[model samples]
Target: MSGGQTQEQTPEAGTTETTPKRLPAAGRGGGGPHFNVGMPGEKSMNFLPSAKRLLGRLRPYRAHLMGIVTLAVFSVGFSVIGPKILGMATDLIFSGVVGQQLPPGTTLDQAVAQARAAGNDTFADMLASMDVIPGVGIDFTRLAQVLALALVLFVASSLLSWWQGYLLNDVVQRAILRLRADVEEKLHRLPLPYFDKQPRGELLSRVTNDIDNIAQSLQQTLSQLLSSLLTVVGVLTMMFVISPLLAVIALVAVPLSVVVTKQIAKRSQRQFIAQWQHTGALNGQIEEAFTGHELVKVFGRQREIEATFATKNDELFKASFGAQFISGIIMPSMMFIGNLSYVAIAVVGGLRVASGAMSLGDVQAFIQYSRQFTQPLTQVASMANLLQSGVASAERVFAVLDAQEQSPDPAEPARVTNPHGRVEFEQVSFRYEPDKPLIEDLSLVAEPGHTVAIVGPTGAGKTTLVNLVMRFYELDAGRITLDGVDITTMRRDELRGEIGMVLQDTWLFGGTIRDNIAYGDPGASEEEIVAAAKATFVDRFVRSLPDGYDTVIDEEGSNVSAGEKQLITIARAFLSNPSLLILDEATSSVDTRTEVLLQHAMAALRADRTSFVIAHRLSTIRDADLILVMESGRIVEQGTHSELLAAEGAYHRLYHAQFTQPVAEADGGDAESDVVGASAVTGTLRPRSPVG
Candidate 1:
């Protein structure tokens, strides 16, 4: 509705091309022409900055985040200590078993010395390290105590981990909630021109899909990352406390795992970027195809649209497959390295136990710690892909949040108090682009309660003239005034509140007929709604339906005819009862009979209100108090219909072109005959009442 073009022709500048071009294969980073609106070009994946900013969103919940971290530490700490306590149980049983083999009342040291004398040094050394008394056999009492302690530790760890997960969920949800609100507010603040440069579907993807992905990634990664990191630290500390030698061996695999994860993540990150980009592009294609489905069928371009969809879908598939395949390599690679470390730890640990350099229970506990250390490392490696994908999505969403917003409303806005609807444009110049000037040095005025009709060929700046008055765009130079006050000084809402517009393109949300009409004046009573509808002829057709005013309009309003939709929109404008009215091809879709009826209705509605009418049909504006003919953004002629006819200028030629009939000369022949000839070709029009 805020486009730079007139109703009938392309704007001189900033014309959008709506043809799809084949993009380069995924990961190649080659951009292509978009189908409807321009797709944002590929950007370099800045992982750290984007990830940091995304996490920064949670700064408001820092206290809850800290609590979650503390819980994770305690949870992992208890779990890490469990294996050591179980190892003490193992020691109790082993000492009892060895003591049972010794003679009654024999000391452990004496037994070890006797075995050493028999040249069994390894067995003796193992015996010397055990805390066994002679004739003792598997002390089940002490073993049960140790087992109970281990069980308590494990259960406590489980409870803490569950509580940590619960808290993390809350923190993540609150952070995402704030983020969603920010994005919604950002969308409304963006200028209309910003939307012109972006496809709706692509923008929707950033707001919906990308943000959803970010939420999921944060939820999954943050909780697991916290627990896994704490587990790694706790397990490593326990491993060293048991056997520093084995801990060093387990850590030998860490650098290798790091290298593997880093290499694979680098490759997968680029693929993820490509994947989401293609996803947005494909969504844009689908949206365009569906929106213009009927038009495509009319033009027989279904096959072309299908082919384009297939191409984009294939690109998304390639990007998705590559990302998954590359990232999938990380888990197995890390596990393989961990297994190598396990083997080395086991071999060295077994030797230490055999030689009694370490107790069998200590060696056993160290092996368990070695496994725990590798497990969290593997988890971290596996989660790298999720983190990469999420960060990619965050960058996309951040782009929207960072987009330049429109100029803010004035701090102290001017109020009209009582609007008269006298509109004036003085020395105004505007262009969609800097080099291509569409409207220049334009000046015009409409007195209060006057109907000013603008007639022009396509691209003649007809629609643009009204757009300026509404301040849909800021002027390059000069100013427009409403009731002698500069429109720029007034808040956009206040200025637009005084005006009602009915464009050629009618938009109706999914709702009942009454609801759609009520959108113009949300507080309007039902009686008022019916009056507006009846005046605009919407009531006549609506009553034909079984449900009448309550009949639901589909999302696309496909149930109604084009003329019916136009009528409903006109009713909406009428209900607003603004001081000023703008009708751009408002009756273009209606039939000749309906147009005649609407013209009369509009004439009555225009009473006591300044109205601007942009019409391509010459007959509709014949009775207008002032008719302006614009060409190439300049006013070529201005006069009443009969006055313009007498001038024999651009309007005279345009009039003849429409009727394709010769008319008597104003000076030489009867003017009444000319009026009759014109009325014969076009339908008769009601005489306009003199402006008060």
Candidate 2:
């Protein structure tokens, strides 16, 4: 089942149940990391993973990332040099004052003339040699030199911007693509049972939303961190070299900022983790509604659905708001601290300048450097919130990637060849949970081309038996065999290829009817598809439609009637032409007329095909080669209809009591009763139960 977006994807996008020729092995899909088994909710978490571990994905593009880093460094260097030149100009301007030294143009010639009138020979003589130049007049070349350095720094800064932007963007995109593919592949590898505990929305969030956050983190992490670090270091160097006193004062507030940052980051990280979990729950509610809308309507659960959805929706809102709120405060708080430090540095620098202990230029330069130092520190602190979220997201992603495969399967899968329809259950047993076994000491055999029928009440392990044959769940004891070979030894794909199944619940993909039929036999020709359709009674209904086989069905074949869906699935099986077939309640939903038609069609298709029927109506399976009656995970009795009826045991009582009941039909006619007045035998009959 899918949403409105399903229209865009392939109709057969969901299940890969098909007749793919068995390969030597199944690909784990990608060579990327698995995020399952132990990561997110696991006991063993690698919280402090090595730098090497974090950089694993970037290893392939090491050269490219290095180029980006280099550009970032160059860009920061240029930007950092701008303030230095400004400070140098300031120093040069004031150094000549206090009679420190004359740098050609510092003292105006007019001022020197006044000093000469006052008999100040040193100042006047220094001004006499000053050569006038354009722009600032005397000594224009030195001023030009300062402006040229500024231009060089500006150009370097721009180039660094372009390079870092391009490189970081490319790296982030590639990383995200690989991560998506890996997550998708791992989802496919996960066993069906794993789905029983996990919700679809949570899984989707890990792949789509959470991984996206991680990608964003990767995008900013390298360029911003490297540049910020370099800027901080450069600023600190300038501050220390200019005036150690002011530098010491500027450093005072850093520890306080670090402490506050750590506290905020911890809160943000926790909130982010909660946000993802709540989002998944909300998504699951939506998915469940869309998939089971019809069931909801049938059960008259509109109010219940709304209540459930609203609860999850509220939880998501609170969690997301909390996360954003906490993350939002980090930047302002960091800026506040930086501003406070700025005021302190300015006040302390002013005193040093007033006492003549430092040049006004040195005081100004120290204040400028102090600001430069705080800027990067503020940024790194603010961005730390986003980075923390990356950690939480990575934790979920790694959980799925780390799951262990069910069993030790060959790296190169071995394919089965020329399978016969023969199957035997050799004292097989199974249990999904330790306390409750679904099947026990079950033994049976179906020879080639034989039709075996199993009938029982619900929970009788009826469905569990067929699942064992398919190895959907592992066997707890004993073994099952196909053509005298241990079934597990033959590769899952090869063995599954030889078996065809028609489930009671019809799930169709979005596609033309012909494509749907071909899904069972990927190579089936149009002729084979049509023939199979005719054999399964789907052709009769299909031909009546204007488009016939060309008609497209909605997802899960929701466009068709239930019986039509069942017949189409049956057609799929017929097209596959597998030697063995499992008809799991094929007639459960259809009216008696359609049931009768399906029965005849099934009979014709079963010729030369080994078939197993999990039948509900006793009369429908009377002629089966063998009948099995199961109870409480054990087969209580089995025989031909007459033989079981004569025995008057568990099977005899269950069949006649459950299947023999009759009532007037739509035409007000009495149907022939299946029971020979034997419902009273061994109390009421318990219909054959589905295998666990």
Candidate 3:
């Protein structure tokens, strides 16, 4: 990385603070804490932008979305038409029976005589035009027919809505599937620093739970929003047609409801955001605790862990309760306002009816429209939470999707072929963070067929050097080359293919023993796999298993002993047959006998091949062709063991501190192992082929 390049700043991930952080306005909008029910530590999303981006994602499904919306309009339209038609039937029944009553002071017989005189054919019509009794004069056949037609419209409307939901599901789910796949692929492209800052569970939640929320809200709310909006529009149109005065009064409630809902919604947004943030924090805690349950139990810190969990859980609860409670009142509050509007409409319409300015049927229809108008208002209020929550989740998912990717590969990468295992660090400099430089002006070379040992105390930048060789990170200012060609010019894949590594922490995937060994060279033949295993002495124990090489290894190869895991990794390296090999504490986890066997096996593997061995045990690398002593990332000393001992420099002091005391104990008094300088008590040694 160039020194001028800087790390991108983001919200401090995995913060334990219960209070939500205020995001800056430049990247994510800066606002006061917003509520999201049960979600804690989640960033408050820019609703308009996130929704726009979300809509952009649904562009491919425009036709399906339009169809769902159109169907929703029709469904609500048909539902709205039902009551009016029923009211018409009510008028017809009232006229047919109740309106047929004899006029005051006139007997039924006198009305019948007048009707008969007009002729029997016109008599029924005459009777229907007259007043009789309220509701008693209803035409049973007509009433039943009207009710039956209403049922058919309702059923048809229901079926259409169901079909619309099904189509919406297909469209929304497919979009979500693509999004999830993108997130998974993005994980591989993200830089190491991204993972260092973010928790794995947080990323998982973004990929899994957040995207799922968007899909679910799309499925449920999309149709409902469309229908509710149409109903509002339809009810308003009907209300104005019935009585303009009453419609105006009913309209009064809308603004009041909106004002109330807006205030509540604003407060709820912060609560909802806090809820999700706390939820993510809680999940991260659980994941960390579970992964290290053994360590926690060993340390007897159960109570402390429980108390931490309780704190997180309580934060989550308070946030969720706040969000739900605030949002929960929207519907009831709108309903109460609606009732006030209903009373106002009724009183005004009653005066109009008495003054003969409006008919009873018109007043009734107006009342029905008023009720219908308020219902969609309530829905709109409730949808505020769903829409905001869904948008919040979408913003998180998009954040991951839009994260910075790794540096792009060269357009035309150079190929490394038949590499001769020569690696050199030329005036190298690097730092994980800007202010702290880890390595400065580091220069070193390892030639083919030489065992180069790197010895240093912990955090001496030993592993950092190995990381540079493998190009896990970019150099700040340096040129690292393989066989005199700058490695950066070559494709990373081709370069890594020429090197193999075995680390102190063994990594074995969940697979059969054969598969784990063959992971490096997937196309390796069975004979090759077994030969590699035999060379590493892995075959000795593998043959004793009931399934032999075919036995399955549990996750991280926990079913196998640490020694066994190391042996398997060594076998994997053997199968790769790389020109250069790296061994980092390869024998540290094994017993004394196992260590002796592994050391011999490793020595044999290193023969006639360039190797870099990082070791804390000085005795293990006594026969190394060259030893490089490192302190704080700089090479302080370099020479053969005897040459460095004679110089009495850094290497000599380290050797004395580690090996000399042990040798004195093994011998009676003098530190002698082979009639040499402290060598006689240490162990048998080959003649010193000193290099200075």
Task: Judging by lDDT against the true structure, name the best candidate.
Answer: 1
lDDT accuracy of residue 613 in candidate 1 = 90
Q: Name the 10 consecutive residues with the lowest summed lDDT in model 3.
A: 1-10
For 1-692, candidate 3 gives per-residue lDDT tens digits of 10001111212233343433311111111111221111324456578998888878888988998898888877887778776767666666655554445465665556656667777634544344444443244677877888788788888878888887888888888888888888888988886556544554556677777788888777767777778899999888877777788988998887899899999998898887777666776776676566566666887877877887899899889998998899898988998998999899889887775554765567777888888899888888888888878887887787787878878778898776667788888999977656666679988889888889988655567766776788767899988988777888887778889888887667788899999999989999999999999988899999999999999999857689988998899899999998789888777767778888877877777766789888867888888888998887688888888888899988876777565655444554444332353443245453455999
Tens-place lDDT per residue, model 1, 311-351, is 98999999999999999999899889989998999899889
Q: Against the unseen true structure, what C-alpha lDDT does each candidate score?
A: 0.83, 0.69, 0.74
Q: List the residue pairs that clash in candidate 1.
A: none
> Mind giving the per-residue lDDT tens digits that candidate 2 earns over 1-692?
10001111111112222211111101111111111111123133344572235558777888888888788878887887787686656555543332333334444556567667988776455445333221242234665687688888988898887888888889878877887898788877776455433445557777787888888887777667878898887778777877888888889878988998888877776677777766755665566566666766887877888987787788778878888888888788888888898898888777665554665556676777777788788889877766766766777787778755456455665454555578899999886566666678889988877788887765566766776788666788999887777877766777788889887766678999888888999888888888988887788889988899999998767678888888888889888878788887777667778888778888877777678888656667887888888877788887788888899987776664454442222223333233322333213333454999
Q: Over the full model, what C-alpha lDDT does candidate 1 score relative to the true structure? A: 0.83
Which stretches of model 2 miss by more than 4 angstroms?
Answer: 1-46, 50-55, 88-145, 352-368, 410-417, 544-546, 661-692
Ranking by TM-score: 1, 3, 2
lDDT of 3 at 228: 87
Off by over 4 Å in 1: 1-37, 661-692
- Once superposed on the true structure, which residue ranges of model 3 sit more than 4 Å away at CA? 1-44, 103-137, 140-145, 350-364, 607-609, 661-692
Residue 623 in candidate 3 has what lDDT? 85
